[model samples]
Target chain A: MKTIQKQAQALLCNSLLASAVAVIFATSALADELNYSNKLLLTGGVSQVEGAAGGGLTPWAVIGGYGTNNEVGGSVHYTYVKTGDYKLDTYGFTIGLFDRVEFSVAEQSFDLGKLRNKVTAGLGADVFGRNQLTQTIVGLKVRVAGEAILDADTWMPQIAVGLQYKDNDETDFIKSAVIGAKSDHGTDVYVSATKLLLAQNLLLNGTLRLTKANQFGLLGFGGDKHDSYQPMLELSAAYLLRKDLAIGAEYRMKPDNLRSPANDLLFGGANVVDLKEDDAFDVFIAYAPTKNISLTAAYVNLGNIATVKAVGADYGNQEGVYLSAQIGF
Target chain B: MNINIKAATAALLATATFLMAQPAIAEVYAQNPNLGNTPMEGTATFEAFGGKEGLVKIMDDFMIGLVADPRTKPFFDNNKQTFIKAMLVEQMCELMNGGCKYPGRDMKASHANMKVNREGFNALVEQFQFAMDKHNVPFSAQNKLLAKLAPMYREIETTTGDAVPPVFPKAE
Candidate 1:
C-alpha cells in the first residue's frame, strides 16, 4: 500500500511537471495574430472523463482544444459529480497541436462517503479509512481522417485513435481482497468517429474501446473473474439549439468483470457487495457563451456504482448531477 | 416501481414537447433583432438587404477590403474599383433572385485570363466575410449568401493554368 501511494504520488508529480513544460513550450510558439482559420466556434468539443476531447463520458474524434490547423491551442477543465453514496471530482489540462494531436493529464478522486465507515466497522479495524480513491490518467489522441466541421456536408465522419494510461493509488485492497484485480494500472485504447451535420444542427459520435478497466479503473483493473481485454461501445448524439447551445445524450457500456464469486470466501456472500457493472447514460446540455469558454451540466445515471447499500437500497440506479467548466485559447 | 414509471413517462413527455417546440423557437431566434430585419432566403432576404442599394454598399465595402488585403490586392490591381464593384453588385443581385439581370461577363470567362488560384480566391472570400461582418449582416444571412456564391469557385479559380503566383514579387 505504501509503495503504491509513493508511486502514485511520483506519477502525479511527473505528469504535472510534463504538463508545465508543454504549456511553456506552446506559449512560446504562439503568434501575435491568433486566427481560428476554417474551424467553427466550439466545434472542438469539451474534455471528457479521461481528459480526452469528447462528450462527458465518451471520447470523440474532435480534438479537445481550440487550435486550428495553423495554430496551437489548449484548455483546462474541472468536473464534479455527486451521487447518493459517492462523490467524484476530476480536473485536467489538455493541449492540442495544429488540431491534429492532443495530449492530456487528469486526476480523479472518488469519495466513498459513509460507506467507508461501514466497511471499516465490518472489517473490525480502521482498514478503509483511506477511502478516497485517487487515479491519475494520461491520455493522447491523434486525428486520423476527415474533418468534423469542414466536412459537415459529406458522409465522412472524423476519426481518431486515443490511448489512456491509468494508475490507481489504492493497490492492496484491489489486488486480493475486495475486487481481486490483477493490477493497479492499465491502458485503454479507443477509436472514435464523430460527425457534425451542420445543416441540421446535429452531432453524433461513436467510440469503441479495448480495455479491461473495472469501474473506469476506480475500483481496479483486470479482475479475476473477467480479466481479459474486452471491447466496449459508447455512443453520443447532440442537437445544437443554437450555434452556442447544445443538448445531448450519451450511452456507455461497461465491462462486467465481477461474476459473483462461488462461495462466501471473499466478503460475506449476501453482504459481499456485488460488482455488477451496468451501462451508464446521461442527458447533457452544453452552453458556450464564447469560443473560449464552455459550461456543461448533465443529469447522469451511472448504474450500480460501488454496490454499497444505502437508505434501504443498493447503489443501483445511481443518479447524479454532473457539472463542468472549460476554458481554452 | 409505480413512481419510477410515472417519472420516466414525465421525462419522455417533456423531451417530446421540447423537440416539437424547437422549430418555432428556431424561427423566433433566427430573426435577429439586432440586424433590424429577419434574414430569410430568396426574395425576402434580397428585399431585406434593401435590394439594389444595400448590395451596392456591400460591394463597395467588399472591394475596399479586397484592395486593402495584401493577399488579394494583386488580383484587383489595374482594375477600376467602381467598375468591379458595379459588376459584383449585379452578380450578387442576380444570385439573390433580386429581379435584376446581370450584364457582366460570366465568372469563368472573366477569371480565365487572370489565372486566379485557390489562395487568391480564398483571400477574396475572407475579405467578403470581413465586409459582411462590418455591415452587421447576420451570420446566417451571410452564410446563405455565401452558399450561393461558393459554387462559383470552380468557375472563377484556375481556369487557365495551375501555377499560382506569389503575393509579393521575388527580389533579385
Candidate 2:
C-alpha cells in the first residue's frame, strides 16, 4: 500500500508538470486567436479550494477565468491553510469556456497531526501509520441564467449549477473502523447565485449544495450514523475597495454525519470519540496587482475536527491563517 | 436617408414641446431627454463632475485616448470626432441631471453600422476610465457615471467579429 501510494504521488507530480508546460505553450501559441481576456480585471473570482471560481470558502456563480462571451481562459492556483491541529495544501487548475462553462481539477492533502498521533497510539502503530489524507476533486459548472456583470442595473443575478466528484485515498479499515465511513468517494451537487452590484461596489453569492461527503471527503463519504445526502448552505459577500482589491467574508455549513451514539455502545461508551463537525467561515482580502496574478489572505475558522476522550486528545476549535495565490490570463 | 429626416422631424417636435413646458430652464434645446439612461436622482453627482465645464474637459481627454488606443482607434479617428465628443458630453451631463439634454441618436441607432465586439467595447471603456482618472474625477463619482453607461454594451456591441468603424460623410 505504501509503495502504491508513493507511485501514485510520483505519477501525479509528473502529470501536473506536463500539464503546466502544455498550458503555457497553448496560451502563447493561441494568444491572438483565443483568450482575449475581454472581461474586467478580478471579475473572474479567485479559485476556491475545490477548484471553483469564488471567494475563499464558497463557490460563486462566475466562471473561473477572465473569458468573455467570445473567448476562452484558464487559471492555476495554490492554497495553503494551517490550523492549530492540522494543515491543508490544495493546488488546482481550471478552464473556462466563453464565460459560460467551467471545468476544474484539484488535489487536497490534509495533514492530520494530533489526530494521527492519537489514533496511532490508541490503535497501535501498525494499524494506521499514514500521517495525511489526500483527496482529488473534479468539478464542472455551467451558467444557466442572467449575467452578473452586465446586468448591473437589474435585480437578476447570475445562476449556475455545478457538481464535484471527490475521491479519497484511504484504506478500507481506516475508513470503516476509524472514521465509520460508508464509502471512499461521493459527489456534491450545488446551485449558486451571484450578483455584482456595480454601483454599490459589492458582490454577493449564495449556494445550496447536496452532499454526503465527510470532512470534504478526506475522512471518506457517508457515515455509520447518517448516510443520506444533506443540503448545506454557503454564502459570500465582497466589497470592492478599488478596481483590483476586494475584501470578503464567507460562511459554509458542514454536515455532522460521523457522530454515532449507536457505534459508541460497541465500546460500552467508554472510549467514544466524538466526531461532531462544525460549520466553517473565513474573512479574506484579495488583491490583484496585475490581470494575471492574484493573492489572498484570510482568517479561517474550522471548528474542532474530532475529539478522542480515550487518548485525552481534544483538538480545540481549529482557527488559523489561510493564504492563496493564483496566476492566469 | 428619408428615415433619418423623418426621425429628425419627430425629435424636433418633441424638443419644441419640451421647450414650451420649461421655457426658462434650458439654454440648449435637445432632440430627446431619453437620449441618456434614466436621469440620476440627485444633483450631487452632477456637482461631482464640476457641472458641464468638467464634462468638457473630460471629453477632450477622452477623445484623445480613444484615438490613441489601437483597439478603439478605428471607431473614433474619424471626421466626426468633434460631434461625437459633444454628444458624449451632453449625454453624460443629462444623465447626471445637469440641466443639459443630448441631441444625438440613441445608442442603438448610432452604432448600428459599427460591428462592435466585446473586446473593442472593453477597450473603449478602459480608455474612458483613463480619461476620467487624468481629470482627477473622484473614483466613486466615476463609478456612478460608469454604472449608468455600462448597460449600453447591450446596444453597442452587436457582433462577435472584429469591430469595424462606420464611415460618415464629412460635414458639408
- Candidate 2 docking: what grade? incorrect
- What pairs collide in candidate 2? none
List iRMS (one decimal) for every candidate.
11.3, 19.6
Leading candidate by TM-score: 2
Candidate 2 residue lDDT tens string, A230-291 = 77778899998877899999988777777544346567655367777788899999999876
Off by over 4 Å in 2: A1-17, A24-36, A121-126, A171-174, A260-266, B1-36, B168-172
Global lDDT of each candidate: 0.70, 0.78
TM-score between candidate 2 and the true structure:
0.86
Candidate 2 has a DockQ of: 0.14
lDDT of 2 by residue, B90-133 (tens): 89998888988787887888898888988888877777878888
Q: What TM-score fits each model?
A: 0.71, 0.86
